[model samples]
Target: MHIQLVRHATLRVGYNGHILLVDPMLSQAGEMPATVNTPNQRPNPGVELPMSVEEVLDGVNAILITHTHMDHLDEAAVRQLPKHVPLFCQPPDREKLKNHGFEQVIVVEDDYEWEGIHFDRTGGRHGTGEIGEKMGPVSGFVLKARDGNEPTLYLTGDTIWCEEVEHALKSHQPDVVVPFAGAAQFLVGDPITMTKEDIVQLAQAAGNSQIFVAHMEVWNHCLLSRSELVEYVRANDLSDRIQIPQNGEKIEYQR
Candidate 1:
């Protein structure tokens, strides 16, 4: 499997002869509005996509929507993606996607199979208490190769470190874990995504798996920088297990 971090939470995944576009917020820097109730208050996508829009869209067979947060599914991406492209999204966002003119928005509740690949929808807590509830529902996915030549993959959506996450790791034992480590926060509460400490905890349970993190620095709400995360990882002596990729960087794993 080849995973390319296009920008922020957006990724281009090439697995088993298919390309899945995950959380594609493909707008240019400042093309969208800023997130509500957050510091920095800057326009969305503080950084630009490392590759052009066309290059990123090329060969994309499907799209995964973790949530409808603008940072994850911006107007720009919706405009660019083919309406007929297969869209796998959480239950709540299914109708929203269809209204956006997408024809094949599939709501992945438990598990769904596409061609030969297997996708199991996993639960997540977007935040804590009221803030979390207000943030609405979110989900991650566990992708297993049909033939088992490639390693199993777990994509953790916008969620903090919690029991659900721990349980998923213990139950699935995915060889590749993609955790959103932006440490995003609103003005009223704790960070909604995994913080540096959260990543450390996840690393301990990851066994021999490699962790690839995205959703950092591109948006104003995401406070943790790659340098800061690197420092923490080094301090905790987890250099081998963690990877914080730059825009347009690709991290690949195979059996």
Candidate 2:
């Protein structure tokens, strides 16, 4: 399968005559407010999109929405997306998308199959107890295509280390796991997502599974640096299994 890291948590998964747009966040730089309540915010991404929102979305078949956050499922992307394209999301987010004018909305339960892919929905906690309670519920997805050569992929939406995520690793055995590892934080609370150390621990638990780390250096709340992460992984001898992609870079995987 071909996976393109669009930016932040957004990705494009291509295989079996399909291009699935996962969490399309196509807004211009600085269009939204800073996620961290701090002074001296960093500049938003100045890079131009590879293609126009309309052009990139042309002939897109479906959208996989992990959550309703603006960065993951923004108002601009939702408004620009074709109404006919089917959207797969958790039950609660389905109504939100449908109300926004998306014609086809599929509210996935624990598992579902569409076209030639099998999708498994797993629970995710945004953070530890008190932090998670404030941030609200989240989820992750494991997708397996019919083609035996294609690698099974796990997309860990915004989440922290938890039993459910570990259980998914044991059960699905994905060839590649994409985790949001920006180590994002707010003004008054602990990190609401996986930190770099968390990524290291997750990689250890995942054993040989390849990991693609995203969600860093793109927003204000996320503070971890890719260079530092690379150093940590290399020092820990995890360079072989971990990949840190730059924005708009594409990586292909086969089983």
Candidate 3:
């Protein structure tokens, strides 16, 4: 399995000979407005795409959307993506994507199979208390190749160390785990995404799983930077187990 950190929470994954894009926020730097209720008022995407838009989209056959947040699936993505490519998402996002003129919007409520890949929809908590409630529902994905050559992959969509995430880690025990870290916060309340402490906890419980950290240093609201996370991991003696890939860098995994 091959995974590329496109930028922030966006990812380009190659599994079982299929190229899949996840949560594509394709806007250019400073094109979108700054996130509200956050400390930094700079543009939403603080950095530019490491590669050109066409380069990122090259050879992508399908898209897996965890949610419809603007950062995850923005207007730029809706406008730029091919109308016919299969778009897999949770049930709640089906109508939204269809309304955007996407020809194939498949909802994976529990588990579904397409070609040689198996996609299992999993639950997540965006945050806690009223902030989490207002943030609404989100979903994660567990993917496995039917032939079993590729290792099991768990994409923990925008969530902290909540019960649902713990449950997913325990149940899936994925060989490769991708946690959407950044510790993104608002003017008030706790972080909406996984923090460094949360990552440490997850790594401890992940057994022998290799963890790849994403969703950092792009958005204004995300407080965690890649450098800071690297320091924390090294201090915690987890540098070998946790990898923080730079934007557009590709990582290959084997079972």
Candidate 4:
């Protein structure tokens, strides 16, 4: 299996003749507003799209939306994607996505099949305390193909490290794990996503799973930078298992 980190949380994952686009925020750089009030409050996507929308859209068989946040499911992505393409999302977001002109909105409550691959919605905690309640609901996915060659992949949605994340590690034991780790915060309250400390814990818990960290250096609210995270992983002796991919970079995995 291969997953391309197309800036922030957006990705193109291909396996077993199927290419699934996840959390597509296809807006051009500087088109969207800053996420929150902060020093890094320049624009939503600080960097431009590495490839054109046409390049990213090639070979896409379906769309898997983790949430309806502007950064995840923005206007550009909605208008660009084919209306008839299948959309897999959480139950809470089915209506909202349908209203956006998506023809097939499949809620990932149970296992949703695409061709031969199986997609199971995994639970996630977007934040903790009162902030979490206001952040709304979000869910991740555990995807595995029927063929033994494809390894199990867990894409943890916009979330902070919690029991649910650990449970997924212990239960599915995925070969490739993508966890959001920008420590994104607003003016007040704790970070809504995983911090360096949390990443350390997750690395320790994974045992041998490969981690490709996302949600960094994109939005104003995200406090972490690639350089900072790289140093943290190196200093903590977790660099061997973790990969901080560059924007538009791709990582291939085998079981």
Candidate 5:
């Protein structure tokens, strides 16, 4: 399996002869509006995508959206991505994608199979209390090759360390785990995304699974940086388990 960190929570995953673009926020740097109720109220996407827009879209046959938040599936993405490609999303996002003029929007209510790949939808808690409730429904996914030729992957959408995450980790026991870890926050609530401590706890719960993290240093609301996460990983003696990939960097895994 091959995974490339495009930018922020966006990813390109290659498995079973398919290139799946996950949660693309495709606008050029500063083109989008700033996130409200947060520090660093600057325009979003603090930096540009490591590659050009065409390069990012190249070879993408499918798109998987964990949620419809602007950071995950922005207007730019809706404009740029081909409308005909298979779009897999949660049930709540079905109408939104269709309304955006997408031709193929498939909702995953629980488990779905396409092109010999198994997708199991998992639950998540975006935040706590009122904030989490307002954030609405979010989901993660467990992907595995039906033939068992590729490593199992668990993509945890915007979420903190909660019961849902722990349950997903325990139930799937994926070989590759990708968590959104920017410690993103709003003005009033606790972090809506995983903090460094939350990442550590995830590492422990995931057993021997390799943890790859991004969604850092891109948006204004994100509080974690790559250097800080690296330092924390080193200090915790988790250098081998946690990986912080640079934008557009690709990592390959063998099953």
Candidate 6:
């Protein structure tokens, strides 16, 4: 499979003659409103898109959206995408997409199969305790290529540490796991996502699975730096197991 990190949590995964664009934040820098509720906030893409949204989406067969937050499900992407393109998302975001004119929308529950690809929908918690309750519900996706030779992959959308996440990691046994890991927080409260230490623990929990970290330095709420994260991971001897991809960079794996 070929995985392209297209800024923030957005990714373009290619496998079996198909390209699945996940959580596309296709808007230009500073074009969308802040969803994290921070003042003086601005969108920073960190790098230009590999191509225009149209160019990148030229032959995409489907779109997999985790949620409807502005950063993950931007209005610009909704407006620019072709109406006929099929959209798969969690239940809460289903009506929202239909209202936005996505005719071929599918609400994923538990697990679903498209063509030859298998998708397992796992529950996610955005944060913990009061912070988590405020952030609302989230979902993570596990994609297994049905070709029977490709590696399984899990994409952990915006989430904090939770039992369901650990369950998915252990039960699915995915070859690779891509997690949103900027250690995001707001001005008012503690962090709501994985810190560097959390990532290390997650890596250890996942055993030998390759872990790819993204969602850093593109927004103001996420304060962790890639260099600092890399240093921590290396110091913990996790450099061989975890990968920190630069914006617009691509990683390929085949099993």
lDDT of 2 by residue, 1-255 (tens): 878888888888886668999888888777776665743266444244556677668668999998988878777787788888778898768778888999989888888888888889988888765767977667789998876657889999998877888998999888899999888877667777788888998899997899999777776777788998999999999999999999878988877
Cα lDDT for residue 119, candidate 5? 97
Candidate 4: misplaced stretches above 4 Å?
37-39
Q: Which candidate model has the greater lDDT, 1 or 3? A: 3
Candidate 4, 53-130: lDDT as tens digits: 999999898999999999898999988998888889999999999999999999988678777788888877888888
Instruction: Compose the digit string of candidate 3's lDDT tens values, residues 1-255.
Output: 899999998999999999999999999999999989889999878899999999889999999999999999989998998889999999999999999999999999899999899999888889888999999899999998999989999999999998888898888889999999999999999899999999999999899899999999999999998899999999999999999999999999998
- Residue pairs with colliding backbones in model 5 are none
Candidate that would win on lDDT = 5
Candidate 5 similarity to native, TM-score: 0.99
For model 3, give the 10-residue run with minimal summed lDDT.
163-172
Better of 1 and 4 by lDDT: 1
* TM per candidate: 0.98, 0.93, 0.99, 0.97, 0.99, 0.94
Over the stretch 7-90, how does candidate 1's per-residue lDDT look in tens digits? 988999998889999998988898877887788799978988888999999999999999998889999988899889899998
Q: 1-255 in candidate 5: lDDT tens per residue?
A: 999999999999999999999999998999988889898799988899999989999999999999999999998998899999999999999998999999999999999999999999999999999999999999999999999999999999999999999999999999999999999999898999999999999998999999999789999999999999999989999999899999989999889
Q: Lowest-scoring 10 consecutive residues by lDDT in candidate 2?
A: 39-48
Compared with the true structure, what per-residue lDDT tens digits does model 6 show for residues 1-255?
Answer: 888888888888896678988888887876655545653266555445656787667688899998877778777888887778788899888888999998899888888888888889987778777877878778999988787777889988888767878999989998998888888887666667778987898899998899989788776678789999999999999999999998878999888
Pairs clashing in candidate 6? none
- Comparing 2 and 4 by lDDT, which wins? 4
Clashes of each: 0, 0, 0, 0, 0, 0
lDDT of 5: 0.94
Q: Where does the lowest 10-residue lDDT sum fall in candidate 1?
A: 31-40
Q: In candidate 3, residue 79 scores what lDDT?
A: 91
Question: Which regions in candidate 2 have their CA more than 4 angstroms from the true location?
Answer: 36-51
In candidate 5, residue 155 scores what lDDT? 96
